[model samples]
Target: MPRIGVTGHVRLAEGTAELVYAELVATLTAHGDGALHGVTCLADGADQLFARAVAALGGTYEVILPATDYRTVVGDRKTFDDLLGKAVHVDYAPFATSEPAAYFAASELLLRRVDHLVAVWDGQPSDVVSSTANVVRTARDHGLPVTVIWPAGARRA
Candidate 1:
């Protein structure tokens, strides 16, 4: 029963979401299934895709919102609301507002709590603190196993 956490680019190109979802399903399946729990921020792109895949597999989804006002900060209100509805548990960081700080705080908590990390990244350098690359690096630094999934021809938006 591995607790898998997710961090990824928010802007994905067309068709990438399906690819990511398939890959996540395969990976989650391989990890055995006593109790699969996925932790995510439920953002518009990869996070939401991972949540859906986890739920489809009969696993529990746990949401870690970046801030108190995450509903307003997140891109797609409908999707965020939908995913949040399915979450078994929802927690928020201490940050009262949203931005890079709140995002980083949420990422740190996700990395700290999960047994493994799934980074849906383009394998590119991240220019910001909360970028996928930075999150992957942080996970590795903490000696957490990371599964980096970037399907062939996948591009970020």
Candidate 2:
């Protein structure tokens, strides 16, 4: 099983989550070949969706938290707790707060550990240091295989 990681927008449109989740399952299924294992931060939107898809395939995943207080900042507290609880292993960045720097550190740690990256991005540019675009770019810069998934009608809210 490939150790897949994810980077994507944290705010998806109303129906975009479902579309993205379906595509993620397909992509992950193909890459996993049979058994599936993923690594994620369990943030809102794409991260949560990816975790759900992993579970649906009876796959296990590890959670890399940006900070110790990550749950306080995530959009969906319930979902975040649910996914975190399901994680086979959990690691935290060397930070006390969930700031951009902490997120960047977490993402970098995730990149170093995963064999491939799955980005649920819209191919946009962002100046934010911890944005999904930067993560995708960083993955590419490191010569990691990346699969960008943006289904039709997918939007960020």
Candidate 3:
């Protein structure tokens, strides 16, 4: 069974959550190559989506908090939510950093631990490296294969 890593925007519009969940579940299901043991993440966007899918698949879910201060970053609500009961571990990040730095560290750590990365990118091209293409690049640099999905109507720049 492979461990899947998920990363995406936390500010998706209404109704996008369910769609994202469905697409991720479908992708993991379609792989059909092995059972997925669990998912690791910070409990937002595609991370939360993957965790829900993992539980639905009768698998475990793990969370690697990007900071020791979960209340400040992702919120206590995200960690304490009823859906996360299946988590085996919600490891705090080893290094200390702020938001963006924490993301860089967490993303790298998540990439190292998981067998595959399912990037739920917005598919937009920006002046910054926040596009789906950037996600593909980072995953490749870390040597993790990436599977990307964007909702049908979300503009890709």
Ten-residue stretch with the least lDDT total in model 3: 124-133
Off by over 4 Å in 3: 75-80, 95-98, 125-135, 154-157
- Distance from true location, Cα of 70 in model 2, Å: 0.7
Q: Tell me how far the alpha carbon of residue 88 in candidate 1 is from the true structure, in angstroms, after superposition.
A: 0.9
lDDT of 1 by residue, 39-120 (tens): 9988778999999989989899799999998898778898789889999999998988888878988999998889999989
* Cα lDDT, all candidates: 0.89, 0.93, 0.68
Q: List the residue pairs that clash in candidate 1.
A: none
Decreasing TM-score order of the candidates: 2, 1, 3
Model 2: per-residue lDDT, tens digit, 1-157? 7899999999998999989999999998888667989999888989989999999998999999999998899877887888888999999999999999999999999999999999999999998999999999999999999999999999999
lDDT of 3 by residue, 1-157 (tens): 7787777766677778788888988888876564676656545666777788877877676877667665455544745565556688767667564465565566667777888888888765544343335555788887788888886754322
Clash count per candidate: 0, 0, 0
Cα deviation in Å at residue 31, candidate 2? 0.9
Candidate 2 deviant stretches above 4 angstroms: none
Q: Which candidate number has the best lDDT?
A: 2
State how far residue 56 of model 3 sits from its true place (Å): 1.0
